[model samples]
Target: MKLSKYLGYIFLLLATLAACKKDNGNYDYKELPDFYIDTVGVQKTFETPQSIGTVVITPKVVYNGSESNLEYLWRVYGTTADTLSREKEFRSVIANNPGTYTAELQVKEKTTGIRALMRYTIIVNSPRPYGWLVAYETQAGGSTDVALIRSTEIVKTITTDVVMRNIYSEVNGGPLAGTPVSIVSNVSSPAADMLFTSQTAVRLNRPDYKKLQDFNQLFVAGAPTPKPEAVMEVPFFGNHLINDGEVYWQYSGLFIGKISVDTKGYKAAPFGYAIYGKNGGFYDMLNRRFIYMEQQLSQAATYASPKAGSTARFNLGNIGKDLVYVGIGFGQNGVSSNPDTYKYAFFEDIDKSKRWFYGINFTLPDQPDLCMVDISAMPNIFNAKYFELGTLGSVAFYANDQILYNFTYNNATNTASTPSVAFTAPAGEVITSIKLLKQPGSGYTGTESKSNRIMYVATWNAATKNGKVYLLDANPTSGSLMATPLKVYDGFGKIKEMCLKPA
Candidate 1:
């Protein structure tokens, strides 16, 4: 019979055979091959803290080489490898979880029995936070070597930004909970495309205003009116920026809400301009409710209250996204419902003021690696800079230490560009000892005992060229000075400032 003619019959026969196939299924079950399992098989390992690992078997793995069941099993010690088997698994473990381990597989090939195994060990851990970091100086010192850097906080590991981050808050922490404070960031120029890197603040003079009121009411025996410089010492640091939230101010008895600082030319100066908003988050640990403050009725034509009267805006620089800058300027307003508000902004009674803005500018030194700042490559901070100015978080994070004025200055413009005068100062040098002290605004300074001896690179006030050199102390008050006056060239005419190469 022709195969085509009997095709249906043949199919039926094959089906019957398949259907009748053994209930005990299979020609033969392939068992894993057995090669004496070596005590030490292919293995990989890593160290704690940080690690990288690899594994190698005795006979280097070969493609299409092994004659076995062709199976791989990887296990992490106590766990079962059969449960977790993927084509290829890369086990990246942190340094903290450490142990010895192995990956074993039982292989068997019916045609040719062959067997092998592989394993690797790994350890992991989180990195430790450094309590102190070295603060390198880009300007304002007369040393040729590394300087001292102290801890900015007693407790550390504080996340730099809160939510929406600003410049000052980017560098420092946020405005404290209790006290009412406001911060700004990434303030550039609406007209000029620039970034702001400087972190600045402001304080209101309430006590002084009360004192002044008392002075005006003096009956020749009443409490003396306090001076603007005397009563208030409320310090406002650049707090973290809030990408979202309304502003608040601490004025007029209660927490006044709906007050914010709007800064133009925020970090986006490269493309266009950047602006920022900020508010005081009043934390009442006792009361529990976040009592907002009032709209800071800025009565002065200051930077904070940049209005028609005054021009106190200073250029920080073309700030980049790495770090943001924030500043507070004061404006003047005629006495009204609250005469006290006038005193908060000390600039209201300016005899003659310099057009110095809160000075925010983004700058890239010729060598940022040496100084550690990229003026050109600023980070992108749009949501934070404009929208959530009130949120608190770090806008910029430094790998190690951070110092102000890290980059070199170009004297193209005298604002901050000028190196300034660097003449030998009078014997009253602040550095009385060679030991260093980390300052908040200023950099490390020599200790009282040792500072007086070591020489320093410094700028001097000029035109009234006096040979006398006075060490600018951390405090406005003239602190201790060196016993002997160092004879140095009148640098006022030569260079405003000079950086000392590491000696």
Candidate 2:
């Protein structure tokens, strides 16, 4: 049986060899038609302004095959893919939100079933590129939302008002928790917007305002409690947050670390300024004194005693007054040598009877070159509810009830000019917030001149349960506001905080 099987296998192999020998080398051969997409004069990347409403793209094709056998399709890819066109050329309205997206052009040959694909980058820019961000609280539910007041273009002066309300909910799908506390933006590289509510704090992406980091995520190892007080970004220095009176520091967007200090009985003031390449200035409410933290230093220290014969205006470690407000005021008259141009800290007596303004060079915290002027005599200084500093000169704006006042200080003579009425709201309205439209950058030119001269005043009417924002053009030199507002936008909730959103 084994011999019979082996003979059968040999016969099968011989049959296969004979079949291969009978086959010939000559055979019918054909090549598919050569084709390619001509990229010359094609716009591979498109930046479509939302106001334009349409984008048109025409791609040239080079092919040796019949054009009638090819089918073309176009689509945009974002969170999902959506068909755009079924023709060779793409002409349609791009309704995607303001963001970066991808688009694809597909060509298919019906006969050969061959497909070719080409991709492009698309950028959709919002018409309201940048503006004033107003965070408000609803009167009914006490929920917080934000509004944007922007211009159609970057003009020297904003003549017309374009307001988008409830923008926080529009992008986030819901209102921020708790009541509004503050809204601030970091204009440095990798810009971001930090929004704080009574219950939590959230860091949002610039331009789009999408939530990036929540309250818990802001800390290296989650926060012990949701007691966010304030978050501040100092241009090129760093970012600081005060939670439960403890200060947290982070450079750029890295993990937050607590400053090395025993913050047991002392609580930090809600507002402070961190200057670039200088020690940060913070106030301790419990000790009622000024504290300094060196650049990139983990520990915060107190300033040394003034040297003998030094003309010290006030002792840094012994400021007994309560802090009223702290903000950047003015700068030296184009003097490049002055490191600390002007940072003002307003203080009042323990009984809130008298007010004083302290001007110091943030760069030289230990120096005696400080100016302290008694501003208690300024009209309505004790009654002021909100304050904002001017960027041009030794000027500041303060609001009390429904009235706004502007006053200038003389660092040379240590005197404060009489307060002038900058603006007054209509009856039944109370001023809630005041902020200067100061764009972040060096030098005052072009739009900076106009932005530095503008002021935003927000008011709320209890009877109508509505809020209004007034855009006022200020005097570039004297800081006096225009007699009438450039524009007024109404129908907002109770405004709590306002900040500039740069383009």
Candidate 3:
């Protein structure tokens, strides 16, 4: 009886201990893993900016701890924050608006209790500007050589507006005066930025006969020969350097869609300039001429980009039976079956001029020396609408025989847009057919009316066997903006690069 009673007591005590143990096992206060704003450092993506047009600032979030590949939640705050989230990005357009702003980033952790938050004070108090245009010189000597006849260097002036584009310029106080020049911007920074442009008085050095000779048969520039160190100034901002296999072209001596063939000759090809390829020719589709041409993508060709009056020129004599020279810009070039001899033609040298017309053409406002080409004769004229239907909504007769002949006020009368120039738009009643009202002849024609505002612009950059051609919108009434480039090909041809003159 005594042993049984002791055993019962022992069991009761054991049961009591078990109950206490279970109560302690349950969690009362929870313990959590560490959480924090993962980012520690702020990174500014933009560096060495030369000018300002549109600058995108992508802020980087530096994280700490074990978190990787975290998705970030971004927030922007300034005069407005709650509403701005709709468009603001952690990586957003910055340094453009001259105002104060802050950014917040939160990167979620893989598991609960581990969170990261990064805060950045991006005070774009002012715009940071830098430059890229630099000086380039070449040397050629020994037995009749072409020295650095031209060079395109970088220029800088104290200004608020930033200009961005490939610039070509001449050297002042260096060597050559009438020489061509070029400045190139790779993916490198500051130099590639819009703010930095060269203007150290373009100084021409000497041209490399080797470079000129290396591809001697391929190119012929229309300009007076100048001794090395004798430079000719070009674009106010300087000329842009072309990549290894590229061709640069702009309108100068002729119409928008027309390039001067000879000093006085002009014709409208599908495009403006072209590039040649490994083996052969381009099928000229625009002019329908038969000659060696430039190609685009491996097999695609044929396109046309014609603004109001863009033009391109060609030389029939320079290209040999085995080789060919093609004009490009719009998109394609063609040769005719009929035998023809265009022994010599005038083409604008890419290294020497900016444009005969444009905003900066008249005055290199900041860079005087770089501005040349007496565009003073006609001020404020973009040279495009001269031969086209006025912006008022009707077609202007285009002269077939002569293009870029002379600047005469009587030629193109001012319309209502200028307001200062006396004219009026019919208040109501839209005209149905502009073609019927337009007395058309040849050089150029349109099928649209005044209400045709351009919605989109595109280039038909196609590569062909003879060359290339460009085609814009199909309507042609009010010019279209479809400038997609297509390539029309035949055999082995060469083409480097190309662009378009959109309406």
- lDDT leader: 2
Point out where model 1 deviates above 4 Å.
1-26, 29-31, 35-45, 48-121, 133-239, 242-503
Worst 10 residues of 2 by lDDT: 440-449
Q: How close is every model to the real structure, measured as TM-score? A: 0.25, 0.77, 0.22
Across residues 1-503, which tens digit of lDDT does each residue of candidate 2 receive? 99999999999999988887755568766697787677877789988854334788787777788899999989999999999899998887665668888889998888888887888888998743567789999767568898887743324356565788887776677888888887877667436678888888888766566677998887778565777687655656566777777677766564357666445446788876866564466788888877766777767776656777666777677678899888876775535235555678889999887899888775554563456888888888888989988877678889898789998877777777888999998999999999877663223465455655788889999999999988888875577999888788899999989987775
Give the clash count for model 2.
0
Candidate 1 to truth, TM? 0.25
Find the number of clashing residue pairs for candidate 3: 155
Preferred candidate (lDDT higher): 1 or 2: 2
Where does candidate 2 stray beyond 4 Å? 1-101, 105-123, 126-128, 152-160, 262-265, 332-339, 365-369, 440-448
Q: Report the C-alpha lDDT of model 1 over 215-296, residue by residue, as the tens digit.
A: 1222223222221110111223122222112222223222222233233211111111112221222212121112222224
lDDT by residue (tens digit), candidate 3, 94-170? 42244445666555655453445555665442222222222212122111101111101111133232322222221
The models' CA-based lDDT, in order, is: 0.23, 0.76, 0.24
TM-score of 3: 0.22
Question: In terms of lDDT, which candidate is stronger, 2 or 3?
Answer: 2
In candidate 3 the C-alpha lDDT for residue 125 amounts to: 29
